[model samples]
Every structure is written in structure tokens, then in C-alpha cells.
Target: MSAATIGGQNGAMPELITIDDVRSAAELLRGTAVRTPLLPCLAGDPDRPLWIKPESLQPTGAFKIRGATNALLRLTKQERERGVVTHSSGNHAQALAYAAKVTGVPAVVVVPYGTPQTKIDAARRHGAEIVQCELAVRQETAEAISRERGLPMVPPYDHPHVIAGQGTAGLEIAEDLPEVELVLVPVSGGGLLSGVATAIKALCPAAKVVGVEPELAADAQASYRSGVLDRWSAEQRGRTIADGLRSYLSELTLAHLRARVDDIVTVTEDEITSAVGWLAHNARLVAEPSGAVPLAAYLNRADELPRGRTVVVVSGGNMDAELFAKLV
Candidate 1:
């Protein structure tokens, strides 16, 4: 779902992309990007034979690398020289760090203090300087870092090039299975949702784009319905089990999700925990809460989905295993 211009402002972000963009991303990332497996649903929703695009198989155990790599690769020589900065919890930070490392560009990551230690080590392994701040102060921290370093900020999901690159996932899914009817994408700041929705809608007009979020942290769903950033009350947001869903909506991402997604559904913390267990125990796949969102949606509202072909984009697989073990 490529976003419309920011309130009719020109050059803020681009519109729906062309096939050439997907092909270009594929070409640029030919040797680097993993052709992650899309397995037949192990859960076997008998009504609709589902498929799981297990992006956990991707390098860094998440799908963010696809967009991050393409974004950094597409940069001009001057842009590359100045380096890049980003604010991310875990997945996107690893993705950007790996991308910058591969392209020989310096990366400074402003991470939330709550980010898992494993993720911090991963970023350090890729040579990204870590600047830690409180989770709620992400934008402010990232902005300060950008000013001090004079580096280009590589927003996780709000940028056009980033969205276009992420859309490649939907384009590939469509190419791989022309009969696909439903595609479930996990939403966070709405980058993957917007990109996948745009690609799916453009290619398979009849297909439904479903966005899933944790019920405790369903601010994106709220924003989609309200046509504005309807953030949760401070109390509710503070208690949501979905720590990764700690940010509010971006105007660019919110507009695209509302216009493109067929429906926005939510899952409880119990359902999310169950989904993670299902992936780990049944499918032998290690998945974080955000990664297991599709499974949560499927299990929570299996009867609501169309009784036809369905595809779920498993967004990431970066759980703190110890934390999950306690939950289970």
C-alpha cells in the first residue's frame, strides 16, 4: 500500500510502484537476499489451504533485511558516504546494520533501552554504533543522533523506497502462486502492511489484504478506523504485552493501511503466546510474538477468513527464547 502524498504535499513519498521496482530490488539483491521458503500450512485450516511465507528463514531471522538492503543499495554515492541512522527495536536494527555493513556505509542505530541483548549484539557484530534511549523517546533520540552525525536517517517503514522494496515480498508471492486469495501481513508502523497491500492490490485485485495486531497494542487498527492517529491511553499502551508495538502511527503509513487493507483484526496475549508455541512445537520454527501474529490471527478468527487460498507473511522470528519459555 504505497501511501498518498503527505496531506497532498508533493515529494514527501512516492505512489504505488511499478513491476520494475520489484525486479530492480531482486536484481540488486540477487546474490545477497535469501529466497526464503514458503511452506504449506502445517496447521492445515481444512477450509482454506493456507501457506506460510516463513521469513524466519531469511538472514537475520527476519524480513526487514529485504527492505533495508534495497534502500541502502539504491542510495547515491554521496548518500552512502554520509552513512545512515535508524531507530528500531531489534529486527530492523539488524537489517539496517547488515545492509550498511555490506555496502561499506557507517550505521548508527538509536535503540530503545528495552531492546533485547541478543539484538544489540547482532547490531554490534555488523559494526553499527548503538545509542540507547527509553522506548518512548525513539523519534527524539533518533533525531538528535541524526543532527549530531549529519547522517541520513533510514526510517524503518515510512520511506517510499523502503515500502517499494518490502512490496517485493507480495510481488514474489503473487508470482509464486497466481491463485492466492488472501495475504495476511503483520503491522508495525505500517511499512510492511502498506508495501504488501500495494503490491497485492495492484497485482491481485480480488485478493484480500488482512492486517493483524495484538489486541493489547492495536493502535494501528484504531488509527485505521479513526482516519487519524488514535493512540491508546497512556495506561493501556504501557501495559500491552507487545513491546515491539511501542510506536504510534506515521501519517504516511496510516493513510496507506486504511485505504488498502481489507480489514484490521487483533489477537490477545494468550493467542499470541499460543501462536509462538504452535510455530515452535508443531512447525519446529522459532518465532517471536510479532512473527507469530499471522498464526494468532488465523487461530483466533479462523472461521472469518474466506474458504479459499490464503497466504500469511510471517514477518520476523527474533524472540528472546527465555522470555517465551516463561510465557509458555
Candidate 2:
């Protein structure tokens, strides 16, 4: 854990994302990203009803599209002509590729080895040139590609535009369910959680925004509790079933989380798979392991959370066919 705030080395405080930033991103995403519905969970309790925000319904089958499109839309024409580069485990890779295709901007994606082939194929279908590298060096690899190609690097979660774009989902959640008392979001690189927490806290002041993650990759939980940014090695985070939640946080995301998020919780791998199964059977939603984690926390850690109308963000549905078949 590092106690120093991000940008502290230069005596500068990192700017925390605000509700206005999220609203602007929402504007940028109006027609491009899906304004996914907040559907009632059929199996939810009568007293504490649960709603599902299915970002899986997005064009790219994930919430990453919101940020990816926003970032790309904000690019200068010259930048767009030169193209863009990013590193993602899966979801963001597909998102950036799709956004680039639609916007006529060329894209290159550096993916870590062992990423789901389903996601890789999806990105390729959208016309992104794919590069493979070790998980530890994925970011550096993207930077190298950007340097060599003169493409602007649109990071998966570390950038403000990306974070603000992900926050649009939170804006919708707040708008749709202003009375919501608890909002559950999956945390990996902290972009979604940071943005959602910012929007939810601003729009629904009384709502408790909680971040969920696999216990196998609970660096976010540890960091939230300690008020310091904690890091886990790639090998350690890779132990979880939730591949999308394997990445750790950045200084910008950590700052937003510390300021806006109420709590961070962890769930077991079994619980995560169980939640995925439940969503398939009960909610009729095919949530990937990463997307199912918010529901996992709600199902297993309810006693630790507030009681009220709750919303779980089903972040994405991009799963390997074989794995989806077995889980569902």
C-alpha cells in the first residue's frame, strides 16, 4: 500500500471525477451507447427488491463501450486520423475496436495472453489489429505500439474520459431509480466503480455505492479500507474466475473510489459462478463471471449492506462459449 496520493510526487492533487463530468459523457454516449434498462429481478425479495442494470445489452455486450465511444468521440480529427491504441483483457478491447470501426478511426489493441477467444474474435470482427503480450507488460506493450505508430493511447481505465464515460451507466441508474438505497458495481481497474460511485453519490445522495470483486482479486477492497492504494501482482489477481476483474486500480480511480464509494466487498469463486447461474435461470441474463460479481456480493454479503431497493450492474456478457455452457 502506498499512502502518497497520486500526483503527490509533483505536489499536485489528482482531480476526482464529478457528476457533471459523467453527465457530459452521457451526452457524448447518447445514441452511441445503450441506455440499458433497470429491470426488476424476478427472484428478488419483496421487502428489498433487486433490479438489474444489464450493460451486457450494450452493442459490444459490455459497459466498456460507453467509455470507449466517449474517449474516441472526444479525439481530435488529427488524432483520429493517426488512430488509437489500448490494452485490455477483453471487454475494453472489443469496445475500442467497435468504436473505432463505427467512427472510422483505426485501432490497435494489445491483449494479455489467455484472454477469452470469444472477446478477441469480437474485437477482430470490429477491425482492430490485435497484439498479444504477457499480462505484466500489456500496458507497456500498448505504449510501445502507440509510440511506434503515433497512435493516441486510450487507456482502459486510468484516463478521465474513460472513467467519465463509464459513469454514464451510473447516471442512468440514478435517473431510473432515484430511491435506490444500494448500488452494487463490479470493480477491476476501478473505472466503472469510480464513475458509478460519483454519479450515484451525486444524484442519489443517500444511496450507498458498493464495489464488488473476487476474493482472489481483492486489492480494491484492501485499498478502500486502508485509505491507501494497494497493488497485487498479475499472477495473484489471475487466480479468479472473473478475468475482467483481474486488473488493479490506478491513482485516479483510487482517488474517486475513496471519495465517492461507500464500501468494497469480496466474493468467493463458487459464489460468483452461482450468481452467474442464478442470473441465467432467474433473471434470464447471461452475465460473465466479472459481471456476476455484484450479484454475488448481494447474495452472499447482504447482511453487511444496507436494506432497500438495490441495483446490480451486470457489466458484460462476453464469456467463452464452453465456459458459458458449463456455468449456465
Candidate 3:
């Protein structure tokens, strides 16, 4: 199938969702997904202190497992046995692989050749088959694989189940820090942000949701302005030190963000560099470009965030050894 539309006229509403969905997801995925910790920022405004949800501690080293696990669990036994497929460059590939294996099914991941070897190797170690191809052709590659094996394709951040699954992070944030008035999340496919927006809008309607993206790969901010799909070349994608923010957005992801997200901000590569290094050395965390995104946003808008409580989604920690060393 193609990318699923999110929160459209016929799409689901975030307001109507019940916490039972999260409880049920947790029950089905217990012992599978880890309870990633929410660590505090060391040097930010102490009066309105900041905290980070280290989703990088996930089993696949990213927050993707929540959605992938939820998706596989919701499938029929026949569908599960038939296997699943998806297109991802990093976290999603490894997550879907681990989730499928945990659910006793097979999985195939379509990745762009530009994907780092660290990610590919990680996925293989978890028992999934890898299919590499051109970057822009990734969706087509997934379609071909799905057609060949009759497998359902699970996109990185484009399905309702996936969005709700990723949103679980936001639910935990609300529970952990009920006083939080602002939350910042990295923007790539928009599933995590949409899920967080949905949950926060319901549980903490007074809170604001902001998305942080690399200036080199700021398609979400651009698309949110024009209200349409935005394309990016590797150059147009940004030469940011954050390799993970190098792709453009899907139509489905853009639509959901347009519906609920409050603001989109772009941070420079230099800013990302500092944030990544800061997170590693000062925060005692390992963060990739996507992972360091929220910190970049906060640094840019340090004056605007509420003066009391702020939460940032420390999305993933899939950094290469050399990359990590050079970044810090």
C-alpha cells in the first residue's frame, strides 16, 4: 500500500483517543520496548528547567520500536506470518526488524545506499533482510518488495498505529512531568510529532508543540509554510553535520503536522554540532543529528520557552563510532 493519510477529514482525531490505547499498547509490548528515561538538561534556565526523554535507549537504539511493535501486533496472524516490509535509512529499519523477530515474523527493509554501514549492520544483527537502492527511489523499492512477497509495507512515520505508537513517548512525558508547558521533538517523518501533539493536545491542551529540524534539511518547516509537499536534493537537503536530517518529508507526514503542530524551526549545522557535542559531553548522552535536534531548537529560542518546565524528545542515538568521536 501507499503512505497512509494522517488526520484528514476521514482520518482519526487526536482528541477522541483514550489513554486505554497507550495502556493496551504497553500491555501488548511489555518486555519488548524499553522504558527510556527522561534526563534533565544540566545548564539550561534553572527556573524553567529542561529535561530530555532519552528514546535512544530503545532496544534498536531508537524510538521506532514503539510503532513497529504496535503495527506488527495489530496485524492478523496470517499477515504476520507472511512478513512485513518498510523503507528506512536508520532507526526504522532496525526497529521493524527487531519487532518482527520478536513477533515471530520475517521482515525486509529497503534503505537508500547512502545509509551508513553502522545502521545496515545493526539491522542485519537483528535478523532482517536489507535491500539497498537510490535515495529518492526508496518508496518505489518498498512497493516492489511488497508486491513481490505480498507483504504489508510499514513506513517509518506515516501510519496511524505508528503515530500513536510514537506518541507513547509524549504520554510518558506528560506523566513524568505534568508541569511541562512546552515540548520539542525532532522532525523527520512527523509521526512522533503528530503523536505527541495528539496526546498533549488531549492531556495538556495548554502546552505548545514545536518541531526542530536542521536548516540543511528543513523541508518540514518549508512545506508547513507553503501547505504542500517539498522536495530536497542532497545539497538542498542541507550539508548539516547531522546526517539523519538529510531527507525530505512524506505527504502524509506533512498533512498531520499542518493539522496540529504549533511551529517549525530550523537550526544551523553549526548549532547542531554544538548541541550534539554538548549532549555527549555535558549531558552524558550519545546523540546523533536527529537526536540532538531538540537542543538546537532550545538554544535558538531560549528566551521564548515557558519559564518553568520544558521537555525535549532525545529521539535516537544511532551514531557511528567515528562520527560520535568527531562530533564530540
Q: Rate the local accuracy (lDDT) of all candidates.
A: 0.78, 0.89, 0.79
Give the better candidate number (1 or 2) by lDDT. Answer: 2
Candidate 2: tens digits of C-alpha lDDT, residues 168-257 = 999999899899999999999899999999899899999999999999999999988887778998789989999899888877888888
The residue ranges of model 3 lying beyond 4 angstroms of the native Cα positions read 1-23, 304-306
lDDT of 3 by residue, 1-328 (tens): 2234343445444332345665566667777888777788778777768898999889888888998998888788888889999998877888999998888879999989878787788788888999999988999989998888899988777677787778788888887877778899988778788778877776787888888888778888889889876877768775677666666666656766777678888788888878888887767888887889888878776775544578888888887788788888
Model 1 residue 101 CA deviation (Å) reads 0.9
Evaluated against the true structure, the overall lDDT of model 3 is 0.79
lDDT of 3 at 282: 68
TM-score (all chains, Cα) for each model:
0.90, 0.94, 0.90
Question: Model 2 residue 122 lDDT?
Answer: 82
What lDDT does candidate 2 reach at residue 103? 82
lDDT of 1 by residue, 1-328 (tens): 1232333344343254455676677677655568776678757677778788888877888888878888888877887888889998768899999888987989999988877788899999999999999978987999887778777778887776777678778877888877889898888678788888888888888999998888887888888988767877767765656555555667777777877889888888888888888887767787778888877888778776655788888887777768778655
TM-score of 1: 0.90
